[model samples]
Target: MACTQMNCSKNGTTSAADLTDDLIIEILSLLPVKSVCRFKCVSRLWYLLISQHRKRLPQTISGFFYPKHRYNNEDGLIGFPTFDGISGDQKQLFPDSSLPFLTGYRQILPKDCCNGLIFCLCWKDSPIDEADYVVCNPATEEWVVLPDAGHKSDALAYRLGFDGAMSPHFHVFQILEGDEDYGYISGVNIYSSETGVWSYKENGWGDNEIQIVDMRGVFFNGMMHLLTCEFKILAVDTEGKTWRTISLLETMCVGNICLGPLAFIGQSQGRLYFINMRDNDSSKLSVWILEDYNGNEWIFKYSISTSQLFGKLFGEKDHMLQRDYADLLLQRDYALVAIHPECNLIFFVWRCKDVLLSYDMDRGKVCVICSLKYHLYDTFPPYLPYVPSFLRIGKPRVEA
Candidate 1:
């Protein structure tokens, strides 16, 4: 029997097989992000449809990538970058963590990750000045080697800024160090993907005394926010036309010391967050959110102690062992790795124990995620939070 297409819907119902790709995408877009991610496993077609339309749908953090250093007999010092997946289905989007597409480089050191793009310093076998700044997207395997910025690598602090939902273009900022002061920022070199050129601006920040404390900066609300030694947030836009500074809470300041602040800045759920240890008490960690962006007001959101975090993990410890553990906690041996983009989960690395742990601010619970492979020495390794995006960067390249 030759049944007509219109006759098949006589009962006002459509079969699963009869649904078109666009129809399925429309339905998936209405579901929660978790449900939309689960549909990826329903079929290969569903995976492709969702991935293609990911920017329109809500996005969540997939995992994190941090450098793991090892001494190879042949290569001397080498970095083996590792990825720790937090989402099951999303992890499948990036099969290879090594980033094999970035070829012909002695080593690739990831400097910063904003949105879905990673900014890396690709060291060549030639002189240090000949190194290249490479930005790559793992999901699409698209990469682009940027033109030289005409500045020495040693004197520059590089940061990547991209927001796929807001715009397709991305920017790279190279902050230059002052020649005489050495601590103050002398100038800035910005590269725009849309213009495909580098632009220079000399210390638009206006305050030469406020030195950049950390190389990592948080990109939020169309501005790159950097923590300064003065315990203030310095922000600059892509055009270098507008500049703003938000003062940190007076209690968080470590006043006039050469040491960097024990604080980190990150963005989650459309707000800027600052996490730092209490200056008076190192064991107490405080989380603050910029509730009023225009007014520059920071509201204290959560606070937790070292005992509350690691107490359940180490139960019924001996007196001697407990004493040693308390000493380690007092010394602040943990490093804050990342903050969940969608929730109140904070990820940190316990250097002394070499384990990754996540603390839930809402539930007041702490859980160990996994053990780290590489041994961390004096300095903490760069832990970059990654949100998977199917956005294409440059021209697609063949898999290496």
Candidate 2:
């Protein structure tokens, strides 16, 4: 194949030696991930150059992978997974959203995603105790099924902890429910990829009586942060050695007349963020950030009103209309899907409207991303934020 104008040398020879290392990287960064992967075979230098600069390349959060409402025998999963591409042509990255690469398991449910890998619960049949925790990279189609931790049935939540920049190994923290108590947590079972083992530890949060309001936990800065029933963020390290508690906004702690505040905890731009709808006013939504991680201080960053979100304000005179809207909003059908890992944006889904939307925190603008496929049987499905990475699993780290 002939070289393009950008790659051709001055003398008309299509030689890579004609370009500087920086120039080659600049050109490679413009291509898709698959194309960049293929170029590694050209030479040893190209392989090293691409491998070292992989993080600096144009990798992005292609979309989200959520459970499809319907089931198919051919797919061999209880909830057939589907992807919704919100940016670029990256949807082509996953030709079969069903994830057929995972063999042997009749059912696979994605529980959480960190960096680029997905944490899933796999089962051969109906029993929950005979389950395996699998971590797989959708981009590379590489998966590793974890050994049974012996307390799969008692698990309340499974959170994946991984930072490719920090280390090649990953950890899975399984929050175990209390033996006698229903809402209380007993301890955590920690799994490490490096040792290929599962270690158990008693609750490290002291005597706080931890009760997670939501099963989903945010993995950031070597710690897994979970929102508690007390409206506070509880964080624990992957080693299960250190534990810390960060309080939510004072106003958010107050109880509500309706179905409690629609709150979610997430990480973006290397900082922890908490977003929620105001309890007193259903129309108002606020975003808080931990400006200083060590200080545990939360600074109110931005707020959006229903008028700004929906594009029209409701007047008090329309009492019936306002009441209906409030009821719909507080019915626990809406969810803050994800906080953009790289930007001042949030993606959420409104089940009542069957629409997925993005709110820009910087510009205070709301944009409809796409219309969701409404399923009557499905409640609020978890939308895991996914940024595809071509990193291979169970491989030695190639240091840049």
Candidate 3:
């Protein structure tokens, strides 16, 4: 946790003064990810220095500095011979492609990834403990399934996030029954990934009245943001072991806005965006970008309105516009790679691929390249979790 500096050898010849901060940054940027991580300890300046220079670095190196999320379009969502772009249909693309890496995965699906792992929570007709929690790496295609969440028929809610700065690198949040009283709501527990175990349980997280219909937890700026459709965003500091609440931007609450379906678009660079259901119209989409989320303060700086993606991008090859888009695949802001919407399937039908577009976020503009699908879907639990004597928080703590 210390940021003090140490003397540098400078190849055992050049004096430390001979190398300027910029010069050292250029050199470190060229080093392998491992070396740079170790060399950061040389000084806090080195840490900030490398962090600042991270973006300009080549993809090969920057991919390590900050693990890149697989842009759904770039990861070949439709994959292989088909290569259908983002806004394509599923049946049209499936003819040429094989089963998606995660074809059969449905309910409680993992629609996002971080570091190198993805989360999967399977919900059957009932909770029977066949296979419940699974953490996998699509890159390595490796998986780790946790023990039963210990939820009987009474698990009210559940969520997954990471706390690298904490003992256990990952944490699972769950709300379960409180007492024998009918639906009194008992405890909320967080399961740690590092320890592969869960904490006791707490209360008041979600058992009040507002049900978390659509939940997307985003870990950014060293914290986890839990997006719910109930009009409130629960932010938990994975590293700090605390929870706070954030609200949707007022700009997003206009028109046919509904409080039951919200989503965490993703964190790009260092900011987080939340996409919520605006109006029933398929053309009015609104999203908010927030930064400086240091657990205590969150600043909403960017608000984006849906502009027509018309022309060749939105229409067919012949420029015949078909579906009017009410959604976005933010490239400049493209961090949510696991989002698989029904509209994406439509993209397959259209045989789309590698289409270019411009990402305009009110003040800034960037060139972004991504594919399109004909479908759009949200990845949240469809039903409320059952309730039971789920272990309450403060139950007990085991050493990590």
- Maximum-lDDT candidate: 1
For candidate 3, write residues 72-158 as lDDT tens digits: 442233211112322233224224221135334323344333443445654332443333566554333445556666655366555
Highest TM-score scorer: 1
Q: Which of the predicted structures, 2 or 3, would earn the higher lDDT when compared with the native?
A: 2
Model 3 spans > 4 angstroms off: 1-112, 121-129, 138-142, 153-158, 163-168, 175-187, 204-207, 238-241, 251-265, 276-283, 294-307, 310-312, 315-400
- lDDT agreement with native, every candidate: 0.75, 0.74, 0.42
lDDT of 2: 0.74
RMSD of each: 5.7, 7.9, 12.0
Instruction: Give one digit per residue, the lDDT tens place, for model 2 in 20-115.
Output: 889898898667556787898999988999989876564656788777756566652266567778855665667787678987766777878888
lDDT of 1 by residue, 178-283 (tens): 7544667877788888777788877877787657766478888898888887788888899888888899885563321223335778887678999887667766
Candidate 3 achieves a global lDDT of: 0.42
TM-scores, all models, native as reference: 0.82, 0.78, 0.50
The lDDT, on a scale of 0 to 1, for candidate 1 is 0.75
Clashing pairs in 2: none
Lowest lDDT block of 10, candidate 1? 253-262
Q: Candidate 2, which ten residues in sequence have the lowest lDDT sum?
A: 252-261
